[model samples]
Target: MISMHKIFRRLIVFSILLQLLIACPLQAFAESEEAIFAGGCFWCLEHDLEKLDGVVSAESGYSGGDLINPTYQDHSGHQEVVKVVFDSDIISYKDLLKQYWVNIDPFDNNGQFCDRGYSYKPVIFTSNQEQKRDAKESQETISVGLNIPLEQLKVDIVESKVFWLAENYHQDFAVKNPLKYNFYRSSCGRDNRLKKVWGEYKY
Candidate 1:
């Protein structure tokens, strides 16, 4: 038989254990995930991806480059990428892949739109094997839909590298500078080309 104090102590420990069991998985489920993509201007990508339902945040950044601690001024080798943090429970990674496909021209290898350089090249950076597999599957599906060979699809499905966040001003340039963002996006011919390439299926 246990003493009252020992019984009370055991009850307390059991309560703590119960709390951990209930809270741990909920905390894990609440955690968001990051997906990196380089599709022309980071500003536009940030703007477009954030509009999606499950996206928690879209931050402009530089990745797939050799530079260490790169900045907007000296990021020559880096591609302008957007680091999107999203809720996996709310949206599937495969759907995000589809959204990425419609938003940019996969055929262009030089760069996307008015931005002409390796830095603006469209890419999908996968952080894990599952992501890589899904990205490739999405790529293949798009290739089949367009009747283009897999090699013809210029968009890359590379393993994610170090992502250097861009300057504060560059983060949400679209939301902050609506007029300029619209002007730049329009002048760059992003929307028109997207409509032409994606047709009625444009996102």
Candidate 2:
């Protein structure tokens, strides 16, 4: 028994509501950006980066390798990396890079903390020219601030390769296995090394 006028008004209202809903998500998606980094242990890096204010998620993964479907035990040539998705409106990529330097030892080319070999090497994986430029600039800023030579900064800034998501059990490892992760992190001399390298710098 609804009049045509009322029905047309209802349709108009519904159309406006649908447009708003669709536009909101598209706007958010446009503001979202991603950056990848490898600072030794994926569990520790993932845990650390996710704590940043604007970061949406930090996912553990493997990158800079050719292996397809790499696994924890057999990811040869792959580095343990964390893919960080962040809201660009809330935080800048430069800020994230600053945090990254404090969390890692740039002098250690072999590996990070107790973790060794190729998989643990520190790296900044850039997805585009802008990221690469930002990373280099950040590295230079850190070197000057720390009074260290640029050549001494061992963290490689390279173009990002295909990022293979780690196994389900490896995701959110610190959250899932806090006690064990804590014990391992403590025993690995990570904090001590970071303190020596960064000298009370808060990340």
Candidate 3:
């Protein structure tokens, strides 16, 4: 038979475990997935993607560039990108792709809206083979659905590389600087072109 001291120790352990379970909910530790998208203006992309149901966080960054630790002013070849962290149980990767396409100008090879540069072109950076396959399929579906040739679509699917997070101020520019963000976005004609390309549908 166990001694009284042993029973007391077990009870203590159980109490500690109960406290841990209560303090940290299971959903707090739920597994999360990540997707990277390079669209024009990381501020706009971050704001749009984070508004999605399953998206837990969206961080503005730069990717697909030769520079190391690229900054907003220094990211010459880097594309303005957003890293989306989401819960897979709430939204699938396919759903993310579907939403991503509607947010940008899929046909513009030059740049997006008023942003003119290599850094402004949209891209999907896949983290794995499955992601690459899904991205390609999504691109194909868009091409076929629009009755446009696959070759004509400007969006490219590239394997993901290092993602350098932009400065903290740039992370949530839309929310932090709403007036300026709105002015810039409106003057850039981003929404107008998106409506023209996507036709009455909001992403």
Candidate 4:
């Protein structure tokens, strides 16, 4: 009879454990995700964002162009962009925006680094209206809080209609050809100029 009591207690405990497990909401766990930017060559930002702890993937692409299907040659009018997939749990959107700001020359309205023209210029293609608001608000904060003056040109925070992946050859161009990537980056002078403008800024 005493042994029966122990069995009852064990059964009750097991039932409670099973109930507890069932009670756990099935909502998907927070996972890392994507955030994109087209500040310049995808290679430039790709390398920087990939260094973060939770970033899963970074691919360069084309966005905000009028062309229906833009290719490298046809991408003439399109901006060079990067699509970064990361673990959202590990890195917040605000942090990603901060990382974006650190890379581009907010003061220069033209293409970032050494690259010139609208195609290489800075633009934050937002995933949603909330992100749009956040991007604008962030820029305003950076202007006042960050030491580097805004180039006085309007920062384009456009809604992305579609993000077309770049050709296979362009994917991870930096990783595939380290020498070429390094040479392109250096010649563009993106790093030196960015450091000069933002290295001292608090943002």
Q: Please list the C-alpha lDDT of all candidates, in the order they appear.
A: 0.90, 0.92, 0.91, 0.80
Using all chains and alpha carbons, the TM-scores for the candidates as numbered come to: 0.85, 0.89, 0.91, 0.79
lDDT by residue for model 3 (1-203), tens? 99999999999999999999999968668888899998888888888899999888899999998899898889987899999999899989999999899989998868899998899999999999999999999988888788789998899899998999999999789999999999999999999998899895432
Per-residue CA lDDT of model 4 for 1-203, tens digit only, reads 56988999999999998887788633233475567688878888888887887677788889888887898787866888998887777777777888888888776658776777888888888888777888887888787886446556345888875788989988878889999989998988888888887777775
Q: What does candidate 1's lDDT look like per residue over 62-123, in tens digits?
A: 99988899999889788999999888888888889899999999999899988898999999
Worst 10 residues of 3 by lDDT: 194-203
Cα error, residue 141 of model 4, in Å, equals 1.8
> Considering only N, C-alpha and C atoms within 3 Å, which residue pairs clash in candidate 2?
none
> lDDT of candidate 2?
0.92
The residue pairs that clash in candidate 1, if any, are: none
Q: Residue 33 error for model 2, in Å?
A: 0.4
Clashing pairs in 3: none
- Distance from true location, Cα of 123 in model 2, Å: 0.5
**Candidate 3: lDDT of 108?**
89
| Model 2 spans > 4 angstroms off | 1-30, 201-203
Look at candidate 4 and give me any clashing residue pairs: 32-86, 32-87, 32-88, 33-86, 114-188
